[model samples]
Target: MSQSAPYALPFHHHGKSKVRVGRVWREGNVHHMVEWNVNTMIDSDMEHAFIKGENTGMTATDTQKNTVYVVAQRMSQRCTVEQFAIALAQHFVRTYPLVSKAKIYVEQKPWARVQQGGLPHDHGYALQGTEVRTVYVTYDKAGKLDVTAGIKELSVLKTTQSGYEGFLRDQYTLLPEVNDRIMASTVTSTWKYTSQPPCYDAAFNAARGALLEGFLGPAKGGIYSPSVQFTLYDMAKILLDRVPQAESVFLNMPNLHFLPCAPVGSTFKNDVYVATSEPHGNIEAVVTRRTAAPHVSKL
Candidate 1:
């Protein structure tokens, strides 16, 4: 908002690192993640006058652009997406006193670096999916602050293990039992930490590890699941229980259907149907509370 004049356009430049991705798979499942980085630049006078229209000393859009690039350059190598978010939030607010508010958002993309032998290549990588981590920050002149971060496009599955029972059945049911079959889903999982972690690597690693293990491992053979919904609850619990910094986990899973296939006469067989990834089941929960962890930061 520009305050110099009712029509004053206090200049601010914005840029975001869009559509970045990374992926790694362990034991037959593919894992992917994404992120987007953003920045904004506004000169002091322009900032001070956005609401007051006092654009006497506004920074030019060209300068703002240059500044964004400069900030990006300064931030690219050393900052985590969260730090970059914090920097972006702090930068414009301090730069412009007129700026009553500022916001920064980072969205992550899923991808995998091609492995040479058994490990990821030194520098080469590839995008996997549209899912991502989302981070948002906002600051107000009143000293109010907000920050949120989470993951995306977390797909998972296991063969002949998970189940979906206790739903209504109809007369069009020519379908067979689903007791032991492949359960597949392309999931979007997000968990927002209440605060920035002192150790970003540790928090990220723990979340990633728990997600992988939970998706791949069925906790108990028979006692673990009453249904898919229940299983999702368990998954959220595991994530909350295992990941320290996160205060909550949100999961969006698209049930990807595969042909119910079986072997016959020593050959592969297909149930013969097209698989789909839409009209997904949505699950959300608070996995942790800020009171539980001293290291957890406030939003």
Candidate 2:
């Protein structure tokens, strides 16, 4: 008979980091700026921390935050969110030998230059809407990369050319079907880039335009939609058609409700309605080419 001795398993694993960096590059008093909330995660194959209580190969989260700002400083001209995230992820894989993978996400808040005297101000700026621009990047030591860009909390509404019908009816079906109604949603969408584009900023702009166009364009609105599922498909399809570099597109639209209301005591009828944000319908779907494949294996 043989007895096996107890052995330690590797355990130093994940590192979570955040960076809030305000970048400004001035070109003769005309300044371009972006505020970013960057998050990075490092996944390693160190299991010794759990079994042996060792913390030697762990990378500090503070170090990751510093790396983000340092990389941004060097990239004043090419300071797109996607570019910064790629640089950050590459840094982790190259700098830390023990780290096997890095996932980086960057969110760029909307800020437009303030207008004064019928002109845009050079230094002054104002916070605009809730629409947020975001990027996610992943890098592996094995020479793999994945990049995704997205928009969040983009409130959209089309008064007409939207409806809900042709649904399964049952005892629980108290809601009535309508041929026309208000369509409102807080859109959250993400699209994975097949390959890194020449200019991430340009790609983002073009993709966003396609999404909005498909949602409310005259040509898109000309066709009738029976449900949000159809609209979601159209939105995603348009994005893929417009952005050739994109491999896939995803959309999550929560159907905000607008119940028709009429004055109780008066015989007057108004076109107004009560809008409800919660307890509403939800529709989500993803569109991609049948032959399209991920650049990197899932981590």
Candidate 3:
């Protein structure tokens, strides 16, 4: 009888530790800064490293760390996270013959331009809120490129134009329906562009603008969301409608509750609320247009 296959399929990927890099650029006192934590993976036919402990195909993680700094300095043109992502992916895929594909994920820390004396301050900046921008890029030997951009920890609240009702209220459901109530969510969204946009900066800005507009625009003139489920769909639809370059969008918005508590005796005001962060409702979905192909890759 034929011998059984030696183990299952071999492990196909290796290389690179997490590399964190910070870059600050100054052009005639106008300062721009970005802090990024990057992780890279190289996929190749390197089962030898796993099966026989032959590590010849491995690229040192230390070298990967050094490469981040070097690439950041060599960048002469204005560098956005998306642009830097492409640069990183291309460098790894082209430099290493053994690397059949490269995957790079970059997280950008938020820093806002400081405003002083009513005008934007030159050479001054402050760390903004925890809102972070993330980018992911994949490059393959066949020249296929996939890029995804996202926002995280973006807090938004609207006192009007949002409501919730018409839910299946069983005995366990204690929440009451409200026509007008405080709606708040920490918005986390990601969009995969149709290939790379002509202008990465423009596409990013437009997509972000669509999100804000969908959330904050007038109910009469814009989207009147009856619930977070409705609002999430509208947000994705607006982005896809407004930005032609984006092929698909994903959104995860957790419902932050501001439950109404009854006023105490005769002095406690009913307007005051206790904001609870944990044990909130998590809603997420992906919106995409009908594609000609049966399957589409995700980021």
Candidate 4:
């Protein structure tokens, strides 16, 4: 390695408009098709991780969009959002030479024109534990393709049913204690891909299942349970294990607290549930990969 190039690789930009159809509903008692459109524009920072003069082999826009079209065409019959993304990205690097890798990012806007009618021909609502999906793709000259997807903004809760205790105490630990308190949050979680082939629907189901089970599992009622930290780790680990594509999981939970009510008629204020958003605790832990190695393969 006598010398690396002194210049930088310029950006490679590509845009695509993709549409998908589904048997949205039996409108007027007859089966009809509904369409979802995803339009995306991608710009790769080609020089960011590269040696300057090596940029001659980088990919171009035509090739990138061709990959997008092929991916979406293949996914016209898919059943899960995550699955669609993974497949699209995988085909890109597997096809092009200049593209030893490519990044696939999509922006899906509502296409059911009926929103102007309050409710359209076929309509749906976003619900709790339901979220928008995103993915990052990576590939290397060694012929590795990684597809990582996640559902963000999924909501979860425990009704005085989840709690933690037995943490070692210290002199500065004047924290109030409650045997049973509410646990609720807008949860954000992510999982990286392993070597497994992408099964968007299967991985989606497993991640959701693991999130729910880990938070609500009977480990407390089971044996050798430690603390809330343990529960979080368990939830993350379970997700990685059950979803073969998942290599590791990272979780961030902000312990949502509701303020205690002040009783007007009675002289008691300790037990009522008056609510206020904080000024609260933020808990974060990485459930795997203690050492910082390349996460390139997992996207």
Alpha carbon lDDT of each predicted model: 0.56, 0.82, 0.79, 0.56
TM-score of 1: 0.64
lDDT of 3 by residue, 1-299 (tens): 12474676445765565687878888887877778888877787676676677878677677777788888887876689988988888888888788789888888888778899899988777899877888888898988998888888888888666788999999899888877777889998888877677887788778888888878776564445699988888888899887787778889899998876565765424476677888999998888877812122222
What's the lDDT for candidate 3? Answer: 0.79
Clashing pairs in 4: 83-200, 194-245
Which digits, one per residue and each the tens of the lDDT, describe model 4 over residues 54-139?
Answer: 54644555555555546655654534444555565556555544444445544332233334365443444332224545455555
Worst-scoring 10-residue span by lDDT in model 3: 290-299
Q: In each prediction, how many residue pairs overlap at the backbone (N, C-alpha, C within less than 3 A)?
A: 25, 8, 0, 2
RMSD of 2: 3.4
Cα shift from native, residue 150, model 4 (Å): 2.4
Question: What's model 2's overall lDDT?
Answer: 0.82
- RMSD to true structure for each model, in Å: 8.2, 3.4, 2.9, 6.9
lDDT of 4: 0.56
- For all predicted structures, in order, the TM-scores are 0.64, 0.90, 0.90, 0.62
True lDDT of residue 259, candidate 2: 81
Off by over 4 Å in 1: 1-67, 109-131, 142-145, 170-177, 218-226, 261-274, 278-299
lDDT of 1: 0.56
**Model 4 spans with C-alpha error above 4 angstroms:** 1-74, 90-98, 105-130, 164-174, 218-227, 267-271, 289-299
Q: What is the lDDT of residue 212 in candidate 1?
A: 64
Using TM-score, rank the candidates from best to worst.
Answer: 2, 3, 1, 4
Candidate 2 lDDT over 39-147, as tens digits, reads: 8888875665555668788787878878877888988684788888888899899889989999898888999899999999989989999999988888999979989
